[model samples]
Target: MDLDSQALNMSSRADLVEFLGGLADSFATHPERWQNANLPDFLNAWAAWLEDMDGYFQNRGESVPTSASWQLIAQMLLAARVYE
Candidate 1:
């Protein structure tokens, strides 16, 4: 993940909220992701990211995806906060 890469655009209210939410979600889920906890948020993100891989490939006209994009990763991270 590009967590240490360029900053996300959060110049507006909506963007700020999205960024804040994503940030908090990531913080809450970090331990679970690495600790192998049975958190629904973690599992949900894992499954969602896997399911979303195909779309990434389709969008890029690639054969198939063996990896996730920053966007996909971000989505997963952001989504991991659903049940947090």
Candidate 2:
């Protein structure tokens, strides 16, 4: 949980998509997490979503330890072809 707030530079949309996909996969594997999902039986999913994102950032050299770091992830996702 040692995130550097000032270092919020996500390189590309592809990275975000990959992160989200991994997050979805993790959520699917953890049924207990689904209890918190807004849907009937799905996990909130955002938790795993965010965790995968943190991992993505870390892999990209950005040590994200807070929710504030998610803005960059959101932006990247918004900029992706799927979102468009």
Candidate 3:
């Protein structure tokens, strides 16, 4: 299998962090949808982490994008790379 042949552009690290932030806000307004949704382990873990970070940011009086956010973004990119 040619790795390059299957490679494609994905969201950038910054974009992913921003997206997570938006998702956090959305989750706050509609937690009911997630109660019964069957999400993959990876996705569920990511959502939990995002929720935690969102709360942390709010409590600490910090910025939106934190180190954990960047780290998670990199981790997702690396996981996707391995499947390629």
- Scored by TM-score, the top model is 2
> What is candidate 3's lDDT per residue for 1-84, written digit by digit as tens?
122222223246565456556556656777675653444755677778766877767787977664445676567767977774
Task: Write down the TM-score of every candidate.
Answer: 0.30, 0.33, 0.32
Model 1: how far residue 62 lies from native, Å: 2.4
Judging by lDDT, tell me the better candidate of 1 and 3: 1
Rank candidates, TM-score, best first: 2, 3, 1
Please list the residue runs of candidate 3 whose C-alpha ends up more than 4 Å from where it truly belongs after superposition.
Answer: 1-10, 36-84
TM-score between candidate 1 and the true structure: 0.30
lDDT of 2 by residue, 1-84 (tens): 111221234445665456556556756777565456545323346557655776787788977766455577566656774763
Off by over 4 Å in 1: 4-38, 66-84
Report residue 4 deviation for candidate 2 (angstroms): 14
Q: Judged by lDDT, which candidate is best?
A: 1
Cα displacement (angstroms), candidate 3, residue 21, comes to 0.4
Per-residue lDDT of candidate 1, residues 9-84 (tens digit): 4345566556656656766768554543556766687778777878876887977834535586578568967946
Model 1 clash pairs?
Answer: none
